[model samples]
Target: MLDFRMDTFLAVCQYMNYTRAAEALNITQPAVSQHIRWLEEQYEAPLFTYANKRLSLTREGELLRSMALTVKHDEQMLRRRLHDPGPGAHRLVFGVTPTVGMSLIPEPLARYHRLYPDAPISIRVSNTESLCAALDQGELDFAIVEGYFCKSDYDSLLYRREPYLAVCGAEYQFEREPKVLSDLLGETLVVREPGSGNREIIRRALSRENRAVEDFRSVIQVSDMNVLKKLLLLGCGVGFLYQAAAQPQLGQGLLRAIPLEDFQESHDITFLWRKGSVFAQRYRQLFELLSPQDIEGESCAAGD
Candidate 1:
């Protein structure tokens, strides 16, 4: 179990503000400072710094946070395993981004449930950023995410790659055979909210074309994937998202992929757990049990 000082340090990491951390911990600001100072002295490294008038974790601080979180998960998981009724019990608390949650995972998850009827699995579906934060807080055991993350912090597996598509309503006519990204800048861009995997993918794709989302005529930010799809169907704007998310509409002839010049690309959907996790082997075994076999050639693990 983590000690009292580590708890204070984690509170500071969560808020990045001493006063806020103190309030959250129900301690005086001076107490928070003393705890942090003690930690710095114990670790023999500075944990935080003020940059541009904002508090940020130092390199040492980030390392400590990662290690502390990993230890916290292991400690909690050990207790859960000790009390668990079944042998070789796996405490499954997993997270997934909405892009993966929409289409790729449900069938495989159901099959796993059928096989391991006793396993108490909980699934958290949220945006990539929220999922990553939860994982750091030891709230998740593993996550399948589709957005950018600090690779050095996690052990990852390449689940599969999915086609990324730029799409529009079938009835929405382009002024020309839009051959490149620049041609569509006049159309209002419909995007997932900031910090969402789909939006980050869109940002990366746009950057490759020497453009950004802001270059669009206007922008519509939607948090709900369903609402975002609906907006696209109404010809309100063009959308960039995973093919799986748009597959139903495309199959129904309600949406069409916008053809881009020589732009056939796919994006990685990855399985991630904290690096050096005590349950790393169990997580991989679970992955082997749940991975969809149809998608080819990406079963190997990679640091990226």
Candidate 2:
């Protein structure tokens, strides 16, 4: 078990103010200072510093914060494990990007339910950054994400490799048939908001060409996948998405592919959890149960 003072440390990390941390922990401001001082003494380093009058973590502090967060999450899981009423007492908590949640979740969830029909499950759909933060905070057991994440901070299993696609409405036509994205630079670009995995993927791809989403005549950011697809199908604008996500619509000729000569790109959809999670083996088992088939796109088993 970790020292209870880690709670105070995390609170300070959250609020960045001793007074607020103390108030949240129902302790005095001086007590919060003492807790921090004690931790600094034990760790033999200052954990925080002020720059431009704003409190921020020191290198040592960042390292401690990462380790402490894992401890906190592990403690929470330990409590849940100890007090669990039996099978299905605790819902299986996990997250997925909107693309995966929309296209890949149902079949695997059905498979899980068939195997353990009484098990409760909770699914959170959000962008990659938010999902990773939730995993660090112990709010989620795992995530299926398609964006960039710090490989050093998490353990991952390669879920699938999905090709990126640029699409417009079936009736929409580019002025030059868009052999490259340069031909479509004048059209509006419909994209997911910041922190979304697919959006980041395209952003990096564009940067390689000395361009950006801003290079488009206009840009519309939508968090809802359905609305984004509707806008595309209505010829409102062009959008980039994973092939799996657009498979049904493309097959139906609702969304037409714009084969940008520059965009021969694909991204890995990964199953992510904390680097040193106590429940890693258990999560790996669940990954196996869901990984073999059931997803609509191509997939293969990945090593730990």
Candidate 3:
């Protein structure tokens, strides 16, 4: 079970405003203050500072926040594992970033269902950061993510390495024989929202070229995969994504890939779960079933 006071403190950290936190928790602002005061008394240190109408976590607050999150996660996991699966019922909760959710999970999920037809599976699809936050809250048994995360905190396995390509509508014209990062300066860019794995990969690659998102002529940040693809097909802007994501469009000649001259961005897709989780065995089985090589091979065979 999770502690109410800890939950209140976490809400405060998340929103960074006492009133907002109170509203979120459906508690009075003074009650929220009372909980913080109680925690401060126990910990013997101030957890937050109020200055210039801004709220910031004190050093002690930061440490408590981390510990409280860990305790909450551990408690959730213990409760889950202690509960019986029940006769002929196997339940699971998992998450994935958009890219992996779109490309990789379907086949394995299908196979898993075939093995345990009566089992119920819950799937959550979001960006890397949100998925990671859900994992910390113990809402997911495991996750597949496409962006950078704190590898030290989880037991992670490399799922695959995928190339990120610059693509645009097939009918769109380039200024010249565009090949490098600099050649993209004048193109409107369709990008993923902040905290996206794809966005992080693009940001790192741009940094290497001494460029940034602002260097583009224009930027359109989209969170929905379908909308982003529609924008690309409509010739709204150039986009960056995993090769797998844009492959079908490229094959249909609806889009064209522009290889970066002397510059290609690649990111690792990884399977992640909490450190020392009891679900490690179950996750390993899933990893073996959904390994990129096996999935890719099956895809190729199906295409044939």
- Output the number of the lDDT-best candidate: 1
Tens digits of per-residue lDDT for model 2, 1-304: 7787888999999899888999999999999989999999999999999889789999999889888887777777677667666856544789999998998777888888887777768899999999988988878888898888887678888887778899999999667677886777898999999999878987898888788989999999999898999999999989998998999999999999988777788888898788778888887887877673834354333333
Report every candidate's CA lDDT: 0.85, 0.85, 0.81
The ten-residue window of minimal lDDT in model 3 covers 295-304
For residues 7-90, could you state the per-residue lDDT of candidate 3 as single tens digits? 899999999998999999999999999999988998899999999989999988977876676667667756765674775555
Q: After best superposition, candidate 1 residue 178: deviation in angstroms? A: 1.2
Ordering by TM-score = 1, 2, 3
RMSD of each: 2.1, 3.1, 5.6
Off by over 4 Å in 2: 1-4, 15-29, 52-54, 87-91, 292-304
TM-score (C-alpha) between model 2 and the true structure: 0.88
Clashing pairs in 2: none
Q: What is the lDDT of residue 271 in candidate 3?
A: 83
Which residue runs of candidate 1 sit more than 4 Å off their true CA positions? Answer: 50-54, 88-91, 300-302
Q: Tens digits of per-residue lDDT for model 1 on 1-304? A: 8879999999999899999999999999999999999999999999999989899999999999888988887776677678787784555778988877878888898898778778788899888888888887778888998888888778888877889898999899877768887888999999988888889987887898788999999999988888899999999989887888899999999999998885676888889888888888988997887787676565655564
TM per candidate comes to: 0.91, 0.88, 0.81
Best-performing candidate as measured by TM-score: 1
